[model samples]
Target: MKLKGSMWSCIGLATLLMAGCDKSPPISTAEEQPSAPKKQVAFQPDWVPKALGSGNFEVCLSNEAEENGVKDLILPVGMMFDSWGHMTGSLRDSKAFDGEGTSGFGKSDQYALALTARVHLTSDRPCAITQAQAVTHQGFRYRHETVPASLHYNFSAGGLYLNKKGGITNDMKGPAGDAAQIGLLSGTPISDVGDVYRATEDL
Candidate 1:
């Protein structure tokens, strides 16, 4: 009987030792694990058009932000209107403007679209442009086309009269004008024109 009891005690000790050896530490949860930092994304502006007139047609800018930090300025040329005041077609143009120059105010970084449109207006009614809407890419500023103070507009001639800044005007009229022009006396480089649409903000 003594020998049998001693054997049972030895078996119990061995089992306990095996169980202790097989034990492992608890596993970690997903919340306890460290996560990598998120990357920063570049900012981009939405293509939403502000109200310009009683009609739905309005001048708008491109929401696309170029890598060189240039935004295209969109101008409304004209929109086809039915007899009932409904819009049938929209005509518009765009010019790339560099907001960042040696000075905060920069020139047109690219050629401007020759803005022209054919609208069927009644003889009694004359369509008039009252306001213009300027759009810029998100995270970018707008640079207006600069003209010499001497430049002036002549409504009767229907043409821009430029002096002293002749080269600038010539550049604006050239096939490869590098800046946007703002004035009544100069003709924009005539090329392909694009339509302007409302911009949506990118989150």
Candidate 2:
């Protein structure tokens, strides 16, 4: 009986020792590494134009803000349209500016379907701060030799370059092609030129 009790005691001690050995140590996590900083791009005004319909379009005015100080001063002054409404075609100079519809507007009236260049907006509503829109014209002729373009009605919407300081430079990569011209006039957004037209019609 004494031998048997001693044997059981020894077995219990062995079992407890085995159980302790089977237990796992607590897991620990490593410290996290710090993240790198992000870089910023500059805003330089680069105007581009795109057509929506036969006589409708949208323009995008991009101002790339560079980290470097070298920049360009783009002007806003352009052809001043008069009471005669939106002129058409390659007709550069029209007849004597009429009184009512007799006022005049001027720009490099290329033979393309739409005005060549775009300008930036002045207002804030409808998200038109650094935005651009299409310029309209009538009576201009087009040919297959160049890209197709839409027409501009009397009430067509467009962008106006206000506070322009840069010379006319065609930076097509920014928005549209280089065929368009940048104006030298300074003005505001003519919201009444018609309602905002969608950038893309086909969805």
Candidate 3:
């Protein structure tokens, strides 16, 4: 995907070049950089990763059902949020698939849920992501894994949303709590997902 305002990449590369240059005149130890103080960026709620229900669906059911039969899929449609309050990730993932067997054949049975649109994320904080594509091992049941999700800001709203890509917002209307939902299936329990965001903030 093409990113807007990618000149930052050039600037970063230039910085690396200057740092690595050997032809530049050697400087006295005192004249050299003492090392820059680590920057501590202030957090903002807007930049926190989030999911806003777009009231759309993005799933397609084919003619296939399990022994117990199956129901048409119901997927969440929403936008991903960055610390800049912009959408950051794609909504499609493995969790979107849920159904039993062989029900999509009939005209009445086939259904489709598609990503309608996404909001743009605007932020200066470096986004942290853990792509499923990054998984080193595959097809192992009960294998323990903890992937980075989102950047935290408030350290209160549980810092920021993990999985900067933003998760599915299954419940548009709330009997569930929170302004946004995190994690897959949109149907994941609010408390659990929220807590994960919170705990990761400490790191």
Best by TM-score: 3
Q: Top lDDT: which candidate number? A: 2
lDDT of 2 by residue, 1-203 (tens): 01222344688899999889888776556775666543222211221222222222232222221211213333232322112223232111122111123122332332112222433332121112222233233321111122122222222112212112321222322211211222111112222233212121110
What TM-score would every model get versus the actual structure? 0.17, 0.17, 0.24
Q: How big is the positional error of residue 83 in model 3, measured in Å on the Cα after superposition?
A: 12
lDDT score for candidate 3 against the true structure: 0.23
TM-score of 1: 0.17
lDDT of 1 by residue, 59-105 (tens): 22212113223333222232111001111122111212211221111
Kindly list the per-residue Cα lDDT of model 3 for residues 69-151, writing each as its tens digit: 32322222222221111122222221222222111112222111112232221122111221111111111111112212332
The models' CA-based lDDT, in order, is 0.23, 0.25, 0.23
- Give the per-residue Cα lDDT of candidate 2 at 81: 17
